[model samples]
Every structure is written in C-alpha cells, then in structure tokens.
Target: MSHGQQTDSERKPQVTVVVVTYQSRNTIGATLDSLRESCDAGLAVVVVDNASNDGTADFVAAHAPWATLVRGQGNIGFGRGCNRGFDLVATPYVLLLNPDAVIAADALTRLLTFMEQNPQVGICGPAVQEPSGELQPTGALPDPWKIMLRPILPGWAERDMRHVVPGERPQATDWVCGSIMLLRWKMIEEIGRFDPRFFLYFEETDLCRRARRAGWEIWTVGEAVAEHVNAASAKATGAHMMWDTIAEHYFRSRFYYLIKHFGWPAAVTAELGELLLMTVRAAGERLRGRSYKSLGLRLRSPILKLPVFPD
Candidate 1:
C-alpha cells in the first residue's frame, strides 16, 4: 500500500485544527509553527481572519500555505469566526485552537486517544500553560459556587479550582475555554454549534451548557498540554476597553443563562451580585497596585461606559 494509504487499523483518525485570527499577525505564525512541529495526527487547518487590516490573511497564506485561509468580510466576532472555520474543515475531530497557543507535539494524539477510549466524552480540552511554563487556569466547570468566588480570588486560584474531582467519569459542565478545545463531529450534530449571540466572552460556556443539556459529556485531559501566550490578541489589538465591554456581555449572558436554565428571580439576583462583586474586585486590584489613580482614567475611557465606583 502507498505510504498515504494505510489499512483501516493502521490509519490515524483525522483532526482539523481551526484557528481564528483577528489582527493576530505577529503571533499566529508561532501558533501555526507549533502545530506543524507537534501535530502528527492526520492534520488539516482552517484559518479564518476577521476583517483584520493588519494583513493577517496574507501572513497566513505566505507562511502557512498548508492552511485553508478565509478572510471574513467584516469583524464577525470570535464565535462566528470559529464557526466559519469549523464549516471549512472536513475532519472527524475539530480542534478549536487560539492564535496565541502552541500545542505540545503529543497534545492532539493524547486528546484523540482519550476520546476514543472514552466514547462518552464528546468534547475534551488540554491543560494550558503560560509561555513562561506556569499553568494558565484554562478549563473548569462553571459552578455557581466558583463563579461567585471568582471575583474575590486571584486568577490562578480561580482557574485551579475544579468544580468536580478530577479522574471521575465524564460529566456535564457549564463550559470549557475555547483555547485548545477538541470537539467530536457527533457532539456538534447533537448539541448544535456555538451560539453567536456572544461577540467574545462566555461563548464557550454557553455552548457547553447546551451540550450538557443534550446529554454530551465534557472532558478535561490533564495529561495533554499547550502553551498559550495568554491574551496576546486582547493586548495587541488595543481592545483593553473591549475586554470590559465583553465582560459586561459575559455578565449579561450569565443573566441570560440563568433565565434559560433556572428562571427570572435567580437571574436577577445573580446579575446584581455579579455587578457588585465585579466592581469591588476591580477596585481591589487597583488598590494592590500603586496605580489606582491612573487606572481610574483608563477605566473611564472605554466606549461601553462602564460605571466606575467613586474612588
């Protein structure tokens, strides 16, 4: 048989890695290079650039010609861009990777092997570390308890808090991070695709919740890993204010999620608590640094008009 043509038993199951880029010209190359080096699994790629004026599409075309590139007509936001990439890929498994993350050589292999062994696991995510090799709290179940505590605790602490014990059989979750997430074709068919209502944040959480309701299991693979240059796009794109705006959307989505899952009373209380907690937490962070005064002006500059508590 030809090298490309293997017996059914010998063939590796295919996985298409979908990366959505929005003005990620500098970092996308590194992300693609990592995939090339580490991905031995049957590999395909789809790069969807969301109306980036930074020549992100041209950069991908030149540097990663192997990838199928799609230049979006306008900024369609994160979920939509990813869905577009997902549509273009023709693999049994779809790996939704961020433009800032680089996969470990065995990451895809490990994730796929686990999913195959555990047929109930419709979606899986790998442990993500920072470029400096520290664990970046990437994936966790969105428990009501965790969400409440998140504002009080530090980022690392919030991330490390697993809602359920690890190594237990597959279970449902509110959502997992979009970074380095793996999804089976079956799950997509059953649960439906990501809801594009969210322009950026909480998009994954909303999708996972729907998947769980549909009886799909979300899995976290502790062994598989990736290095995520965390939040590079957010910083590079000068969307620091956009971060807060998206955060408001996240809280709004939480209210929406509560209404969808629970009811109105719960959503109302949840929204109030979230608003108060978020405001306090942002204040606390400013206090910890000596730049509270400077941070005030920055907070005021966003287009979304987030109210700053009188400091």
Candidate 2:
C-alpha cells in the first residue's frame, strides 16, 4: 500500500443535505447559515426551488454559491422536489432538511457518528426543538386511531388517553417527521425514495414504513438537536390562498396514505369518521355563533368528493 493511501474506515463519510424550497426566502437564509455552521468538508448542500418567485433562488445563488441550486421546477411538491434533489446526491448519507429548520452545530456530526456505529439504522432523525426551545413531537409512529379521534376529542382528553409525549432517549421509532432526517444511501438503494404520490404530508411516514418492512431500523437520536420554524414556507404559500389549503392537502395525503397502507376498507372508514367528526364540530361551532369556514372547507375537501374506494 502507498504511504499516503487511506482505507475506507479512515475516510470520512460524505453527506449531502437536500433542502426543498418554495417561497422560503425569509427562512432559507437562516437554514443555510446553520448548515454552514454544522457541516464539515465532507458535507455538500443542494437547494431545489419549486419555482419560487420570491427571490428564494436568487438568494441561494448569491449568498450560498457553495450550494448547488436547481430552479425552475414549478412547485413540484415537497416529496417530488426532494426526489429531484436526491438524484444529485453523491454522498453515502443524504440529509433531508426543511427550509425552515436549522441544525445545531454538532447535530449533523452526532447523527453521522451514530449511523456509522449502527449500520442497521437506515433512517435517523434529530430531536426537533421549537423556537421556544420546547421539544416538538418529531419521533412517533403513525397512530391511525389517534389521528381519527383528534378531531372529535378535546385536546387534553386526547393527550390523556394516548399519553402522547416526547422522550429524550435514543430509540427506534416507526417514523420520524421529515423536518430533519438523515438517510442511509444503502437503504435508498434497497427501498428507493419518498413516494412521489405524496405531494406534501405523510410522505415520510410512507418512506419509513417501507424501510421498516424491508428490515431496516428507523431511529431518532434524542441528543442531536435542531430548531425548526414549523411550516413557515407552507404558511407563506397558504397566505395567498383561501379556505385553508393546507388542511385540504393534509386530508388528501392522509386518505392516500391510509389507502396505500391499510387498504380500501380502512381508508373508507377513516374518511367517513373524519367527515362525521368535522360535521359535528361545525354544527357545534355554528350553535355557539362562531365561524366554521375552515371546518366547512375541510368537510368538502376533494378527498371527500372521491369515491370511498378508488376503482
């Protein structure tokens, strides 16, 4: 062997951080700045702008020339834009970061170290912190029952019933939120990437489900942390639209996820339950003289319009 040659163990694993942006001008700068602080020489960054006209692409080009920017893809939705960015990753690790989330200085390094030690872990996520420093519920398996009961039950009652809480121990989870995730390239080779059918929500859940089914572990490293300004870009986009487009998108994704995973019967029952719950809530709101525009809009979402089971 040559004197200067290095073995695979001696070589640091490279990572590519993929951020999908859409009108995320305000938050993208902070996110990039934090990434710069967290990343080492082995780290590369890619920003895929979904035809954002709010100077998001321009800002990335000017301020973050080190990052590879892919623009003019015309709002291809989160999952698809992420897939496009994934196509550009040449690293062993791919970190999918939300445009509004900022990793702590040692967060990326910690995640990488953990993954290196545990080859069986295919997907790992950091403990997400809200701007207030409170822990967000980033690590949880999808609970179809809780999701269904949420609309009908009081918040405190639901919390009591489910004992829903975040933990500080690094452990396996069903799925972590997509706000910040570190994925193994080998796992991608085996299970592929996020399902393009999911335009926004539930895509991460779907991906994690597939990975678990394929015998890879999904874990959340509680010690590694990131601060996320949740849904900043989505809120910005929704500002231009009426009738809570975000909620509608969520319902559509939920229906697709349920049908894809649990089959037609489960999806239909859940959809009907959701419709009934929303209708009751709307009536109660009206009786109290409160506006129920958002509830009404959700009740009429396209998910409800679709046949309970697709042909």
Candidate 3:
C-alpha cells in the first residue's frame, strides 16, 4: 500500500486515525490537512466531535469530507470520545491523535514501519513538540509519589524520582501521552479500551499501565515527530478560567489511578497532600482578594465523590 491509495480489499484498512475533537474549530482543519499527507498509506480517518457548540463538526464535514465524522451527543471527555471513535475502526493499527496536533507528512509511514519491524511492541508514540518546536514531556510514566510531591518539592528532586526520561533514541517507556498514540489492534483486543472513569486527565496513564501489565511493550519512535498545540481545546473551553475545576478533575483522576494501582494507602496519602496544597493556595488567594471558595470546596470534597469513578 502506498500513500493515499485505497486497498484493493477495501475491507481492511491498514491504519485508522482516530481524532477526538471538542470546540476545536480553529485547529482541526490543519490536523486533517496533515493527515491527508499520509492518506495514500491505506489510511482511514475518523473524527469524533464531542458536541462542540462552535460548529466544529460542521467545519470538519465541509473541510475534510474524507473523514468519517461521529457527532457526539454531548461533551464526552477525551478518553470516552476516543473509545467512541475506536468503535468504528476495523484497521489493524489505530492512531489516536489530537485535533490540535499535526504529524509530519511521513510520520505515520515511519510509525507503521517501526511497528511492523517490532511485532512485540503494542503501543508507540512520536516525539511530541510544541508549536514553537520545544520538546514536550509526553513520554513519562506516572509516578504517584512524584506527582504528590511536585508542588512541594523542587523540580530537580522530582526529576530524579521519575522512572522514564525522554531521550532522542527510541526506547521503552511506562506510558506515552495520549496526544499521538499508535496502538496495535491486538493490544486493544487483549487489554480493552481506555477506562471511561477518567474523563480528562490520567486516562492515558491508566491505559499504558494496563497495557504494560498485559505484557505489551510501549515505545517511543523518535523518528516520528508531531507538533502539538498544547491545551488548545481545553483553553477554548475556558479551562484557563476554571483553574479550580481543572485541578479538581486532575486530583480526582490521580487519586483513582493511585487507588487502582497502588492501593488505598497511596491514594489517601496523595489526597492529603493535595488537600494541604489546595488549602495553602486558597488561603493565599483569599489574602490576595481573589475568590477562594471553589478551591476551598475542592479541598473539602470527599475523594469518593469525585466525577466518573466508582467507590
């Protein structure tokens, strides 16, 4: 199969690109355009639009008619939305891409070749760089203790505590960021789709952890590079304005991840650390004449009541 050419069988797409979009009208076009560069490689594209009021769906329909658009009923978070898109893929390989990320013209081809050469590797991601060309730390495994201590500890100390370090050479990792994940179909069949319990954050970490536990190797292909507009969709949704809400989701997901993998003790310790951090933040905000009520409430909310997770 070559770039932009449809397979004769037509029943099997070699690669399926799944992009989940939410209020991404401004960036989705460029993302689709970049994917078009690799369409000849027996590629199938699916765009799952999470009920964007901004006509993001309509924009995709008009701009990239080649992509099958799944119109969501409401704002399903990234993981769930990706699962929805996955339901439509029959390809052997699926690439979970972000609407604000653009891969190099040959990026998909390089990733496919790498995966073909290494059958044991189930999931792989490219070197993610910001639009300004700075490398993004998308290849780190989640460290509960480090995450809990990040706010209180210095950056150097936390760096030392982390297990995976991003490097130029291709290497195995605990998890790759969800931004541009290329996953083998067999792995998904074995381990299952992403956990819906995680709405926004830590979902990818959970997926990678599960994959690793299932004996699948996660890798980073340095040759395959992507430029991501970091947090573009989140910013569009006013995530910047609702710092408390964002922090709430992050901490809730973090607690759930820790509890599931490490145990209740770890989760409890993490929650306490977060509570202390939020209390100090709220106090400072109040002293500075800023609204601190939401932060205080986040600190007080029961850990079990956090969104989308079971007790």
Q: Highest TM-score: which candidate? A: 2
Candidate 1 vs candidate 3: the lDDT winner is 3
> What is the model-wide C-alpha lDDT for candidate 1?
0.69
**Candidate 1 vs candidate 2: which has greater lDDT?**
2
Assess each prediction's global lDDT (C-alpha) against the native: 0.69, 0.78, 0.79
**Index of the highest-lDDT prediction:** 3
Which pairs of residues collide in model 1?
A: 38-105
**Candidate 2: C-alpha lDDT:** 0.78
TM-score of each: 0.75, 0.82, 0.82
True-vs-predicted CA distance for residue 65, candidate 1, Å: 1.2
Which regions of candidate 1 deviate over 4 angstroms?
A: 1-13, 37-41, 138-140, 143-160, 163-174, 233-249, 276-311
Q: After superposition, how far is residue 124 of candidate 1 from its true place, in Å?
A: 0.9
Q: What tens digits encode model 1's per-residue C-alpha lDDT throughout 40-104?
A: 44477889999899989999999988788998888877788888887876667889999988886
Local error of candidate 1 at 266, Å? Answer: 2.4
